[model samples]
Target: MTARQHDTVGELLARSHRLGADPRNTNYAGGNTSAKGLAADPVTGQDTELLWVKGSGGDLGTLTGEGLAALRLDRLRALKGVYPGVGREDEMVAAFDHCLHGKGGAAPSIDTAMHGLLDAPHVDHLHPDSGIALACAADGEKLTRDCFGDSVVWVPWRRPGFQLGLDIAAVKEDNPGAVGCVLGGHGITAWGDSSDECERNSLHIIGTAARFLAERGRPEPFGPVLEGFGPLPRQERRERAAALAPLIRGLASADRPQIGHFDDSGAVLDFLSREEHQRLAALGTSCPDHFLRTKVSPLVLDLPAAAPLEEAEARLRELHEEYREGYRAYYERHAGPDSPPMRGADPAVVLVPGVGMFSFGKDKQTARVAGEFYLNAINVMHGAEAVSSYSPIPESEKFRIEYWELEEAKLRRMPPPRPLATRVALVTGAASGIGRAIAHRLSAEGACVVVADRNTQSAEEVAAELGGPDKAVAAAVDVTSEEEIAAAFRAAALAFGGVDLVVNNAGISLSRPLLETSADDWDTQHRIMARGSFLASREGARVMKAQGLGGDIVYIASKNGVFAGPDNIAYGAAKADQAHQVRLLAAELGELGIRVNGVNPDGVVRGSGIFAGGWGAQRAAVYGVPEEKLGEFYAQRTLLKREVLPEHVANAVFALTGGDLSHTTGLHIPVDAGVPAAFLR
Candidate 1:
């Protein structure tokens, strides 16, 4: 490395340390960072050392030259196949398992091998909030092209150890003299002959993303002012927990025959799901290198046509069977005898929708990155779902990336430059079901999500369930009032730089005997539900428009809005107007590039005070039963006889708001468990 390049690395290494106290550094520790060094094995046999990597437990500002341990390239490359977890690490060192010389043997940074592959004189990697938002974005590669131009060559995620190293060489050959590559879902990498260019690129990419995120419409950016996000219903959590512990252990077990007890840590339960951890599916992993290890997708918590453990297991088996079939097909098509064999290439660990991520990796890096990337994928998937979809590399492309020998070599070679590495997102009404689910999803995807709700306590509660503090913040907002909505959006822009997806799921529902409903009641309902939705959407659009960003404006309407409901006259009427407004807004905002859409969900409950408090009780009275029976009522109302939750509704919203919805506008998608045969169907 040149003196100048060395100096650039030195500068970033310095600035990164400054990130510690900054709120933007929220979850950087859970993430990783690295740098390329000066020593190039001396041609004169003078030992030209080339790289120094981040040692574990060192914070950014606290870092110094000593903070990084030095490892030689050739020695580093030799440790590739000394299988991890086969025996104690120290034991292997004493046994001379591989080249083990780091002075103190602080396991060379996890991304050590990948860094060596860049071949660039100097490089830097970071999982900053800004760039991660975009990287963790669904189809973020495309977004990168749209925003940063095609100058950046994006490589699909892969396992970083051996494969990434080799893949980088292959990519270097494919592209022939490019600046650098980006690992989807993981952090970013930037390299230059001069350290300034490298540092500039890193900051530039991250800054670009930070600007993009700031421009994205985050409905509200409140801090964790919420005293609490509702605790998972313990009684229900326990019942479900007891019923599923063995099942979870079995699903996660590598050795199926053995009944291994699960480690019920707070982290595990913290992610436990009333929705059966289907939320986990929403967060498969946030980094791209994890793509290879986790196989680009995760298992979802989808119960089968029938339930009771056997049926659930059977359905899950079918899912695995399909993955296997797809994997076999992909391998057969892509793998010739000449093809390299990759372990865990076939997305082995499936996300049982409501359950947390599971793994079948050979070691910790694979397991951990795969899991983190899965979580990242989940957030982007869900957040994108809120905006539009979770589309990644196309199926054909995924197949190629999964089995491409050259691409595999690239991933193993070098870490990707941060795509949308460090960005923050704010989603409103992110407390209960859909909002909570989405907040968790975005957080896992790498964007710090500020969960907003009227219930301050519940909002904070949701934020807590996610990592902690800045990673996810919770706040309350009454979407109906223009003042509140404006303030909320302002707060969000202040908090996370700006917003990405402005999800309006906050509204009140009131069911009444048509004649019994007074005009005042009608006006009140309109203000809270319809008017409130408009206010939030209006403010979000203003901010986005001002920021020169055209983001997604998602409004949660009801299935009744598509048609009409006699009992829910006011809500239905208001919602119909809301849906119509979305179409109008879509048309008007199309020029602004801000996509507007509505989600019509049926049979949803236990979320808003509108649904559970008023609507449910009123409907229950009409049915001469308890209010909790609302799901049965709505399910029976539908042909499928199944209830849809707020998350499913949010999913449809997610699908329509991103790049996939690039061509779509003025549409009302439904997430009603297959309700409204003609409309939803």
Candidate 2:
């Protein structure tokens, strides 16, 4: 087939990326795209029509040719005739598998049948917020007609499967001139002989619906000011989210803990501030596609102004139990005798009166996705409410889609989870520099982090930036003080059951010659670098041993510890003591399965507080170079001629804590760009 007859695979990919890249068009992997093309039949040696649909679990925004599953169009379409007699959802999935063009590939999307039924060569299906608003409106059918007239078709809500595909096909057949179709309480679909035509039609319908809503006027904008309070800073709002995360996570899981992600963006704040928020949010998802991700309704909690944290905690616990009961009741009301077992009754999304919204998941990435989807749902719901009463697919239809085996199978097909998925990590000095990088990396790898620092403000800022309280929390700890160290450990235990890994990185650098180094300076260095390491390690060990979970402890020593440097006597001596502490601690803690290690790094000057606090100028003066070139000067001194970065130190710490070093302990890994003097003997 020539380009005129069919779109190139690259064109199809481009179309999918265009639609998926915009949050206005899709959320999480909620949308799908397909293009009809010719594939040579291996046995028959003839060109046959094949439908390349977005594979299940593929995100359209980052879609590629590999993400599209190739299916024999003739075989896929023929399944409709045999589908009416099929009763089970699993059987339908197996039937689609049999129609695959290649020996192995991702399973086609559940909507493959719908795409196959369309006679057009190109089809795009999306759950855009604007389109969903119209589909979920009380007078959705009338709104569709008003928006697009005869150019688009309207199909009522039907559970997605062979029957739904047939209904959609019938609608298109009756209205051959229609370029698009709106599924009540679901999403919109557009089709044309060319990708350009399909995309243009899809965007036009979305724009029309958005304009219609705007013409009706929107609800009053919800201001940041609460009833009895002045507007709070974004930091304060993030603090509220951080304070609430542990409570919600504790309630979500009784066995394995879950992570929480916070979103207080203008859209989320505006939606939650509305007087009708609870009523509308409880009405269920704006579209059926979101049921699998966010559940039917979000759990709403009314946080009283200036209420004590203890009171808020108690209220959340009570409301969470009530939400569970409501979910169970909703399930029983809709379940038939043959319905599948319940998928736990925990709420995925929660609404707080003053704190915006929170989403829970087993990992940070999933939680963030859930947050994004809920935020998009807010737009769709608000758009519907702005025009007419927000209506969603009936509970019966939502239940079927939520419990469908095909949908659950998509989740089962996901790759196994990464290591440290449910573990908790605490990083001292995380307000900036190496500790901050380590905290970010640990959270990325699925660990809940506690960002502990004496600088409470900076610590909280880091916690807020790392997806808010669910993924991390801030704790104030003067590591030199045993009381503060113990309190920080207690906070970690309370926040995440108990810490599994502790990074002892809180210390100071004192660079002065032997004669210039005062007694006070020497004492200050040892107090923080030596005493601080001991207290943190001891507390971490006590907690991990009591919990019977083997943990890891890593100290951030320095290259100067192993190889003395002129005018760096106090810091080097203190770090050397810290290194010895690791060996001693490992020997004692090894019996409890706890491992102790250290990373010796040098020249991490970028975000390092040490360099920012006069040490950089002193070092530059000592080398007779400008302060700005100190980093470069140190880099040139290293054998590899590379600057040591905080990320490099963080990676070294991660390697020691990970499985590769399970049998290794009591070692100091150098991260000084291959400094031979600092190498371990």
Candidate 3:
């Protein structure tokens, strides 16, 4: 597990691990786990999949840098081969050759094969005891029969190997949209694009299985309790774990990513019987969790509490062949044209028949995450079973996780926009028209927006109407003067401490004949629209750069910049320059950590100076026509029939400034209500 160093991803990974480690799960080992990064991938530039997992041997609670092993997705899929006599070692060697040639201290897990089939950025796999119990009994078939009914396809037991892989592949192939699979007399599996979802599925399955088992009543209670075996000494464990004290405290304190456990307890010891234990041991994991490790169950020796490893290994081999044969037959029956065979990825988890359990993954971190999830399920299952039995999702529902296309789609899709509780933005000329509209939109999305405009009263009025200083602040600013722009930004920063977005909406639309246009006319338009935007961009870039944060700058240009318009030379030229300045600023600020973009709109009719006031009277005077006649003139420009509003321009501006485009440095958008199309006609 290479630490994210950054707090966001690190914390997600930590939470995932803690959840997996519940003793309610078969979280001891041999599962898979993963997380999406906080920052989107720069290559695909999508804000998803910064992290992921392959749970092998370690428990999530105990995971560290050595636990997780990373691998390229493309390489993980290529391990497609079946060797009847060859063991897990040979198969793992092949996978390692391709996956970890130079990963330097990192390796892929055996479960990597199945995990590769998933598309989610975050993945976790685990097996709890109840799941295995249901998977192993003669009643196992009946259990699956009753639990899944028509929803899940119960696969007969098969030896777990390439052929078993082939069997699961068949189910997956046939379903095409299932969430996961169930081995007859075996465990269940579920998957999703995110860790929260995967863990949720794991819990849901455990609940159902626990319910089914509880119906049978407490088995006549006669297991050789391993002669009063107790949990590992907490004092000794805590003392040894002190090496991680700093990291643990930092994370567990609600400040950084925390690492701890909710799975260590006494309930697990008394809840399950030898038969239940035996059944699960024979069946393997309920699902693909504990993936290539633990051949469903572990070696169950009635030995002394502290049995040695030597005897355990001897006992482990006795159970391997049965697992193999069952896995093979499972493949023959279920695997067909529909399923993608489990091409032997690697083997980390193995059932030893009661020496507890064991599993291996590419890295220790992955092992720990799997282990933790396993334990969590186990503990939860035990408790749920104890209380009114565990009633889990039906097999059909489980199968959805077992074979979920929706989960696959979520994995493949990029991350969505985060909740907008912490964004700070400034909307220039926000007192009226489109500027005011943009400010409203930003505020609605949870951003603290500064309505910057020369109309102080109007800005204040709108801001107050929208709910005062908590969400919006009114700043009377003159875009033409650098000093004014600076003061406005300074005040906003003083209040909000920073700005992440700048929507430059301060500009004028003066219609003067080309022959009569004066230098002053052009200067007035350029100073506020072009130069004003430039000044705002410089100050924003400086703040963002110093903080090592990134921001977006949006200029509201005009559609006339893209084509010729009658009697509007000064406004057109100023808009064209404003648009050009956006690009230049984008380039300059790219290194400084800021993005610049523009929206060109020709028709924006809200409560504007022209439309809200005496627009019909003034337009009639200018055109020497009746007040009502001008409506048709404006309405005829767009093919949509609906007149364009300032809110429409605000919508486009908002989309370009947030979500993943926080990384996109330069671009221009046209929001002219199809005016350009009409112009072309």
Candidate 4:
């Protein structure tokens, strides 16, 4: 086919990216796009009309040509004639698989049938938050007609499948001039002869809904904000989140423990603080796309501003129990005997009166995704209220989408989860150097990391770089202060329920000879390097012991601990003390399932605050070389003549904390690029 006759897969992918990039339009793999094209059959070598649609389990924002599954249009259309009635979901999926043009590619989206039947060259479907507000309203059909006139057809709520496709096609046939159709309690569909026209139709429909809501004279877009409720500063909000995390984690851990994420964004806080939050939030999700992430509804808690921790904890337990009972009953009432077993009865999002929103998942990323969708759901619900009473799809339709085989199949096709999928890690001095590398590596392995450092601004910067509040949290920690260290650990526990791994890497260097060093200089080095490590380790042990789950503590010691240096008396003495502290702590805490270890790294100057704070220049002076040549000098000192990097040290720390050394503790691993003088026997 000529390019003028049909849109290419590249054009389709670009359309998907534009639609998916906006969360208000579509969230977390929630939308689908398709284009009609021609391709040669592998067997017959004859040109055939093919539909290139967004594949299952692929995000439209990052869609590629390879991510689109090509299917024979004739085969997909023939299925309607083959079934002739309410088609079977299983057979439809199998038929789509049979029509796949390539040997192995992503599975076609569940909406392929609808896209194939639409006749338009380009079709864009999205669960835009504004449009869904109108789609799920009690008078959604009336609202759709009022907003878009006859340009948009209204299809009542129908469980998406072969039947839904047929319904959409039937609507199109009656409203032949319409540019799109609004699926009640579902989403909007816009189609045109070109991708640009489809996108314009989508934006027009969404804008129409927004204008309709604004003209409804609701005075304000959101609900009435309750008195005595306001936003909390970031640090204070984090502290509160930390205090509530263990309780949520413990409750969610009934079958298997999960990491908890706190969302105290202004939007979340505003929604939760509303006087009518509890009554309104129970109305269920605005669209079926949110069913998988947020379940049926959120668990709302009545936490008073003046409530103590104990009282709040007790209330949380009661609310969780109520939520579980409600979930079980909802399942029992809706699920068919032949349906797959129900998913775990856990609340994905929890709304607390004074604490904002908390989302739970097996890991940080998943939890954050849930939080994001829930926030968007709030926006839709608010919009619906502003226009009229908020109405959701019926319970039966929700049940069908939640337990649909195709949806479950997409999840099943995902790659295996990482080893530290649900684990939580806290790394001290993580603003830069080895500590920063460790934090990033741990997050890459699926652990929720707490970036703690004395440099509060730097810690915040690091957390932002690691993907913000979703994956990492910044905490102001001065390890030398017991109170600050305790608070930081509390924040970590709150951010992710409980800490599973602690890396004590905060240190300072003093290279003056013993006779030349002032008492103040000597004390400063020992206090930060030795005393700080001791305090942080003790607090981490206390938390792990209380959690009743064996944890890991990895101390970042130095090569000088094993090899004496003439001018490095204070630093050397402190490093030696830290190494001994790890061994002793391991012996004492091992019985509690806590593993303690140490990594002795030598001359890791780059990115490290110690070297940045004139330590490199001091060492360079001693070596009679320029400061820039110090790294080369250290590299040559190693047996391998290779420069050791902070990332290399991070990998070693990951090895110890991530079950590689589970059965072995009290060991000091070297990460100095095979330095003969620093090698441990």
Candidate 5:
């Protein structure tokens, strides 16, 4: 932790951030950066050479010192002597642990040797789209010479490993003037005596390659835009995309439920609209980093953009099956007897003619990043085909990288998924009260949440508080409006594939007796609680059915619904409607494996939105108690005498939907502490 040592690592992080900020420099978590520095050894109190490199699964853009692995440079170099050659290169990754400099901060990546063994103070191995384009081009070596004139060397296609590191080292030694090497069929690597020089070299290579492609590249490399492949109108495009998302996600999740991301960026639209796009995409991506997230290739829709909806869905199902079969065959073709079992046969990226791309992963960020990587692949294809043909590494090489033993070990080391890991939940009225608590709880349990509320600002704040768009997104929704309810469901589908959990928690109360209840009061209560719940559930059921992934719907009913509280006609009737809907829908949807349940709370006066908006004062007047003491008044009547907080109701929702109640449906759990009258008979 000396000043000098701190500055070195700090500078490395700063440099890493700069490079990662721009997608042109590298992809999300794609590249590695390193700086060799001197640090005092804990054992001998003597200066020792250390390599601070970006750790495995670390993204450069947000890298911290903790994300950098600290390794003993001398020890790392020594391992090369015993490196059991190319066939045994996989063993080298484990050996990195033995080279730790006082317990490495993070696990060393597969590309560790590329930085440690290089004859330089700083090194960067990047997967820049422009650089990869030239690397994967048919005439890449000649293009390298033509562009940089020996300042950058060309190293032929080789899987990234200890041997590739050695090969780059030797190439640097042989060409004394070389600043870097374009790794054929992979990426580019640059090194310098200083960090600044290394960064400049890396950028220079990328810029030069891009310029060369633009200057010498042919026009319309993918041929003219196909007649039926043009993009749809913006509004129509998104509408279609949203409409198809659930069905596509369902097919993709047949092996495992997947969170989804939609990208209608101009790049995706342009690529999909071209005549030669399918042929280029079939060549697959070149860099290993790209395919690891995007899969080898995308499943492109074969029909025109204007195809009939029913026909499109039918064709997509066929295409999905074909994609899976192709992927399985690819695995079988190159897998060794000892290779790890095939992970899954579903396509990670799907390209619809006019609808753009849909990428799926275990979570929102991963799915979004997967889509971004495919866009990078699209750019790489454009650049490569513009000059020579778009040629990537052989399929066998991609297969090897995809199923590498080291990668499998990395996967095995990851923590187990949370209970609601791949689930997406939409909670209406989530801006505050019980709905907000439910949203937070579901997010903590790893569900992507949509904070749907009539209050747009409050909902957005809640979504942000729950960890931004990756974890939660906000949707402006008026539960009473069927259009808004449908839009909320669409938002959930677009944000994280489709909904798996829906909470009908939105409510309003009118504590009026039959004589005092106005027609308007009764209508408003029924509209928001009873009718709103019905609309949301209907829309949710439609999406869940489309996804073919059974889901859960929980209604926040009330004790008044069963307890027949005095002077609570309008609200109680609405609650009764909700309670019955739960049983009715559960019986109907059970066939689709969709669970319907309810939670009946006596009176959540403290944090209830209904209570805060005049209901508490009105109810307090009827009970002859102060509004402040209403919670205690209700609790004293229950068996447990415990005040029900929003969190308690949220916990009840979780209990019913969080997997334990998988077999229990059409059931209502009373959350009024212990309301004897509210208990199910």
Candidate 6:
């Protein structure tokens, strides 16, 4: 193929995105793609050969032009002369920057050498499960031969570096007809003369390998599913997962806090219940991408599926400590004088016998992705065992990659985490009004939010708007029902390990005189507001105690709770109950490191479910003002003459719990624009 047939950067990006969009093609952020083409040199106005490849840490499926690093082909290839051999390949990564054409694009990936040194005009290095399965098999080379004949070759394991690139290039030169090679104990590397052809070669390798495993592989690669280890009924499974999540998360976050993700997918359950699960799990994953996210291995909870909860908890603590010690030893065995310090000594992924997997990271996305990558590892293991004994790269090799200077550099380049990076918040009645605003604010500050509301649809919509289930999840809760309140808190535990922040914002109001208010009206008001707050608090406190993590519970009480408002009997009493509960719980939970506070907003009529649902009009009539002027009437009554919106109340919630107010508990913040009567004296 001629240089004229080379793909443009745009086409390269399109190809990459397509490949990345499918998990079958490559794991997330696991592959690199490159296209060599000619571009007019900025200095000389002369056509110059250039290499454009995926940048460091960029996912291929979401590859944008900005995510591609561009370098002068001549300069890049010239590094071959200065190549300080395999022992000093780490220096080669820094050298890639010297070959940059203009500002380049994204930071050049460590795999840059593999693409630049390769002879092909287009190259793709991917971590597809099927291809990785073939790569990880003990008889990988032999299987490669049977799977694709000579159309694809086999390359022995070598840590990813300049030498590995040279080895692959050498293989390509020898096997002139080969379109790709199964990278032994790694993944696959495919190449073509054109972008379209490169993609085809990649898909061909993946498809062919998958088919080979499916057709030629033996049945029951994982052995029989152990009877006592099979997944429990759906409800039981979830209950177990929720019950176990807090303990796992707390243990994993010993060194540094981590958000959690739970996966009960069929694939995970099937793998966990198999007889060979322990043996294979101990072997760890083969792909560097897999271990990078999931860690070198997972900490498995070894117990019968029907183990008692107390026993499970005790075993989990023991397992976590053992895992930590093992991790430290692994680091010690591999650390060099210049090696980066061990990041942490905690398991990123944890597996339970009856429950699902729990994965932890700095944020929800990272946690979720870690679980997904582990699933990929499961697939690879199953395939490898079917054809041949599963074999992973040696621990030393993984250590080199995990603590590589280049990888450390990439880590350094990452932006600092958000304020609430590892925190999870459960906001009651979060579907709309002040609750929704609070949800948005906490999420903006980096907390994973559980949008708890009776309105499931609206709650889900709010969760989606906050960035889907990773950043936020919807949990239906009437708050009044102890069962539903428990379920909502359980959802928070299941969705994000456990709750760090709970906003008791669910409430209802009724404006009626003491003479007119019936016992039923009073009961309803107290039931939905005061009683609901109590139920949510009780449930939230239980999870927080289980996690052993200090938490915040902020009650959205009203000015009416403190101020004696005219013609307000039932609603005022409920608010007063909620307000006092804050003080009472603050004192009770202080020893547990739980801080309780309340926000007193006079009337957030603009964006309030309570006010919008006719309370605004009722209050307007009580004040003898037009419904449309109710906000103005309330504002005029305030010293500041300001109309408080839901956002104002939301801001106060953050102020109390957003770190600065760490020591300020049992405090009531008035977001009422400044109503003197409502001021807490």
User: Which residue pairs show collisions in model 4?
Assistant: 242-494
lDDT of each: 0.55, 0.80, 0.54, 0.82, 0.93, 0.91
Please give, for residues 1-681, the per-residue lDDT of candidate 4 as tens digits: 346324487678777888788886788788788888777777897888888888876788988877888888888888877764665655686678877775626787778888888878888888888888888777888888988899998999887777778888888888889988889888988898887898888888877878887787375445577764555566766777777776676676666667877777887888877777778788787788786788889987776544677887788889889988998999999888777788888788887766678787877767777888888889888788777778898777788888887777777877887767788888999999999999999988878889999899999999998898768899999999999998988887766767878898998887788789988988998899889988888887776765556788999998999998669888898899999998899899988888989999988977878898999999888788898888889999888898888998999998887766679899999988887878787
Reference-based TM-score of each model: 0.44, 0.74, 0.39, 0.85, 0.99, 0.97
C-alpha displacement of 430 in model 2, angstroms? 8.2
Over the stretch 278-385, how does candidate 3's per-residue lDDT look in tens digits? 433333333444322322333233333234544533343343444445545644554446444433322233222222222322222333344444444444344333
List the candidate 3 regions with Cα displacement exceeding 4 Å: 1-419, 610-632, 660-663, 677-681
Identify the runs in model 2 with alpha carbons over 4 angstroms from their true place.
Answer: 1-7, 221-231, 335-341, 422-501, 506-517, 527-681
Score residue 29 of candidate 1 by CA lDDT: 41
Q: After superposition, how far is residue 532 of candidate 6 from its true place, in Å?
A: 0.4
Give the worst 10-residue stretch by lDDT in candidate 4.
1-10
Model 1 lowest lDDT segment of ten: 254-263
* Local accuracy of candidate 5 as per-residue lDDT tens digits, 1-681: 988899889889998999999999999998999999999999999999999999999999999999999999999999988999998998999999999999899999989999999999999999999999999999999988998998999999988889999999899999999999999988999998888999999999999999999999999888899998999999888888889999999999989999999999998999899999889888887789989988999999988898988898999999999999999999999999999999999999999988899999999999999999999999999999998988898898888999988889889998999999999999999999999999999999999999999999999999999999899999999999999998888888788889999999999988888999999999999999999999999999999999999999999998888988899999999999999999999999999999999999879877788899999999999999999999999989989889999999999999998888789999989998888878788
Task: For candidate 6, write residues 1-681 as lDDT tens digits.
Answer: 224523488789889989999999998888999999988778997888999999988998888888989999999999999999989988998899999998998999888988998999999999999999999999999999999999999999988888998889899999999999999888999999989999999999999999999999999999998989999999999998998888889898999989999999998999989999999999997899889888899999889789999999999999989999999999999999999999999999999976889999999889989999999999999999999999999999999888988778888988998777799999999999999999999999999999999999999999999999889999999988999988887888888999999999998888888999999999999999999999989988888888888889999999999999988999999999999999999999999999999999888888789988988888999999998899999999999899999889889988887888888889988888888888788
Displacement of the residue 603 alpha carbon in candidate 5, Å: 0.8
| lDDT, candidate 6, at 491 | 88
Candidate 5: segments with Cα more than 4 A from true spot: none
RMSD in angstroms, all models?
22.5, 7.6, 22.2, 4.1, 0.9, 2.0
- In candidate 6 the C-alpha lDDT for residue 592 amounts to 90
Candidate 2 vs candidate 6: the TM-score winner is 6
- The numbered model that scores best in TM-score is 5
Q: Comparing candidate 1 with candidate 5, which one achieves the higher lDDT?
A: 5
> After superposing candidate 4, which stretches have Cα over 4 Å from the reference?
1-7, 39-46, 84-87, 103-105, 217-238, 332-338, 431-433, 450-478, 481-499, 538-550, 559-568, 583-593, 601-648, 663-667, 670-681
User: Predictions ranked by TM-score, top down?
Assistant: 5, 6, 4, 2, 1, 3
Q: Please report how far candidate 1 places residue 527 from its true position, in Å.
A: 1.2
